[model samples]
Target: MNPRLLLAIYLAITLAPLGLSAFSGRPARSLWDELASGAGMLAYAIILAEFLLSGRFRSISRRIGMDVTMRFHQLFARSALVFALLHPFLYRAPSKPPYPWDTTRQLTLTDDLSAIASGVAAWLLLTPLVLQAIGRDRLDMRYEVWRLMHGLGAAAVAALLLHHTLAAGRYSADPVLAAVWIGLFAIALASLLSIYLVKPVLKRMRPWVVDSVRPVAARTWEVTLAPRGHGGLRYLAGQFAWLNIGHGPASLFENPFSISSAPAAGNRVAFIIKELGDFTRTVGRIRPGTPAYLDAPHGHLCVAGRDEPGIALIAGGVGIAPLLGILRQLRLDRDPRPTLLAYGNRVAEQIVCRDEIDDLARHHGTRVIHALQEPPPGWTGHSGMLDAAFFRDHLADPGMREWLFVICGPPAMMDAAETALIGLGVPARQIICERFRYD
Candidate 1:
């Protein structure tokens, strides 16, 4: 589906509760009271939607890019936190039991102890939940442990919110509105189950075994996996997968990495991973024939269906992994489109598969440009950062406006390259890119 249409659907789903509340036909309360209720409803709705967004649903992530999906998940979580925090404080009505004359509780807010307790619990849990996610890297915790805590914490908050809303909300007393809340909450739980239980079971049925693990560049290793008893992953050139090696299928020790091997290179899948995280640091030691499981083919950094006249690939350090997949596929298919690769690294040793990249230039007619920040003596390639000036010097061509530009790299390098490419007259829509970080 189109990204814009997906966004529109998201807007509708998030705002549905607000719209439903407006037409509930209840006695109108003060602006503050209504705003408080609306905020609470909006917050809970967004929180429920967060589950689906983070559930790794290919339908959503594949269409909008997993980076964008995860980004929305984080931002929406923060927004829900703000709304939930302000929900109680915004109420202007006095907290008291319902009087005989005021059956609709118009003159007073419900002082139900259990309802308020649940709401308070959810509110308190939300702040630290979002804060921990935003600063997850700084926390002295394992990635798998943090992921477990985050998931359980979110589920608890959702349950508390559901109880608080149905028990205390003015509009939620209505059957239609109450059903909506219940339905959304159920869907959220289902999404969680699908990820943690269903997908793992499916992956367990189709296991893979490690084929090889070897050094590709500085602090980087290439790990290959071949299907144990079935055909392997069917994926595009630049997609990624969550790989769990030498672990149970249901384990949370997996890490996402781009598929560096070409799709045309048979069923054996490969990943180019750098030594960054705990699991990644052990990639060098992963022995051949170790059992592995993959949750794969998730990403939008592919250009298979595009009609661009030419292709330009910009990569930084290990970010060259996915671009290598794309280049290799193009070569295997004997693509006639002009190709250019601008690969930048701090040192020449950091360049992965340098001979293969150069071979693409020598044998396949790819225009390869290498940039080294700390270049060795007598180096001939660019000797500075890949900024706008570097792009203008090497990428200034009349036909480039219609070409497709694919970039994968560090955040700083991707940002600079994007800005430079746009400034150099490359249309933003024609530029395909994906980030590794969500926060």
Candidate 2:
């Protein structure tokens, strides 16, 4: 599941169709016509690859990190859009009746109305699909609704494009290439089925029940759950899970949340979620023992096997969820590493588990530093945003580069910290960061 291996596989699958088309032994066509076909073929392959890159697969997302996987998905989608948009326009010739002497009809494009209709339909459908994904956050629809629509739209577009390719494509007339397209489409379907169907069915066999939901901070609640029959989740610290509280295993009503409690805390897993969405705003209303489902142990932000002598845990607002799990695990293991926690919130009330974080500092030797943008009167712990200045002033020790710096926060703060870390001569590999923004 190495990132390089996944990338190599991606390039091979995407380019193989183009290679096969080029060597399909078809009669020579105009360069522009060949280029047009190449664009369409490449675009289609990339479009199909997007399903695997959707972060539903642990091999892709966990290996490369969810943020990187998602970013690649977005980029590949746009690339496919560009190629698809120009696919038809790049052609130089129109369909014409083959001359009596011409056997291959290389001068004419496919004039099949059925094939053309499918292509047109795919083209029309893909435009809004890409646009909707780009503007997903701006839309007012529920996340689950958007997710379902995106999946269905993608499937329709893929199906239409497949028909158009097999029917209209010069190289796709070859049996081998046609089968390759079918195989790629099948893989896409299998990936979706694995995520949507297989995983859900497995989660249903070992369901969970909510233990409690209590307000821990401003607009934030600590929701805990216990496995109904199975031994609790065995995930590493700093990982996350998709929790479906009171929702069926097959339902798309789950949301991803980082595990806030340590693995040593046993099967009773906990999550610190804020009121960011419609489902989360009602976290406090869920009664005890509500049936829940978990598709969990995702993410790669943990430090279980690290060789660092120290740990720097920096978080912003609710981004502290995963980092708390890391810190708590370190405490439970009686780890001797020097630890520093820099937690920031807009106001004092937004600080989650303040007493517990402070207790980790006293009992486990973790230096818990809290930063408030709007600190109360005569507050002394650091103020304003966790900008580059804060990182430079606080984490500038020479030996700091040897420590693992785990950071999760708003995009701006994470960016600033990354820049500051590089400026401080810390290698990028020494830093672990997860962005809280889903979009």
Candidate 3:
């Protein structure tokens, strides 16, 4: 599950077809002709590989981290789109049917309508697919609807590319190369089946019920869930899950949220949710005992077995959800490692669990520092943004370089904090971040 090993596997899978085709013993074409085929073949394999990089597969995401996995997914999709779009336009030779003299297709491209149509369909579909994903938040569509469209559209593109490759590709005419395309396509389809059919069926056996829902801070609610007929989720403190309320296990009405409560708090699980969407704004209306389902323990933000001498938890607004779980877990276990919490907010009302955080400082020796951009009268704690000045003033201590730094917040704040930390001589690996929005 090492990141390097995963990347090696990916390159092997994506480039294997190209390598095989180059050595297929076919008659050589012009250099541009070979490059054209290489571009298309690599793009096709990358498209099929997209199925496994959906962020649902633990074997891949757990090692690379969801943030990196999703970022790679978006960036790689654009790369494939470029290659596919220019595929047909790259050829310089005249388009013609295969002749009796050239059995290996050294001088001709496939001219059959079936083969050409599939390629054209895939080429046209790849454009909107990438564009929609890039503009998902701005588009006038529900997240679930967009997710469905993405999955179905990707499947359609992959299927068309499969037919196009087997029927029109010169090297793919070989039996060995043809089998590789079919096998990879089958693996791609199977990954979709696992996400939609197989995982949902398993979730039905362990349903959950809404235990409670109440206001925690401005426009934020704390929702709790308990197992209905099974043991509750066995997850680490800083992990997350996809929660579906009043929906069947197979439904797409789910959102990913971090666990705000520690595992030591008992069988129930809690989430700190901010009202940012249509479904989230209805959180206070959800009644206790409503049916729910969870696809959980899906993040790599935990520090359970780390050897670091100290830990630092940095938060910005609702990003404090998972960090609270980590702090609570450390307190419950009577962990003696020194801890520091630097929580930032826009105003006083937005500082959630204020008293509890203060208690951690008083009782557990947690150095809690509150930074407010819009502090009230007579503000004594750190004020202004969590900028380089704030990081230098509080975390310039030599010991901070060795502590594990966990951060989650708005993209801008997270970027500033990371930059400040690195500039202050902290190693990149010592800092951990989890970004939910691939954008």
Best by lDDT: 1
**Per-model TM-score on C-alpha atoms:** 0.98, 0.98, 0.98
Question: Residue-wise lDDT of candidate 2 within 156-227, one digit each (tens)?
Answer: 999999999998888898899999999999999888888788998999899999999988898899999989
CA RMSD of all predictions: 1.0, 1.3, 1.0
* lDDT tens digits, residue span 69-184, model 3: 88888888899998988788888666787789988888888778899899999999999999999999899999999999999999999999999999888889889999999999
The lDDT, on a scale of 0 to 1, for candidate 2 is 0.90
lDDT of 1 by residue, 344-424 (tens): 999999999998998999999999999999999999999987888899999988789899999999888889999988998
lDDT score of residue 328 within candidate 1: 94
Question: Which pairs of residues clash in candidate 1, taking residues 3 or more apart in a chain or in different chains?
Answer: none
lDDT against the true structure, each candidate: 0.92, 0.90, 0.90
Candidate 1 lDDT (Cα, 0 to 1):
0.92
Give the count of colliding residue pairs in each prediction. 0, 0, 0
Q: Which ten residues in a row have the lowest lDDT in candidate 2?
A: 96-105
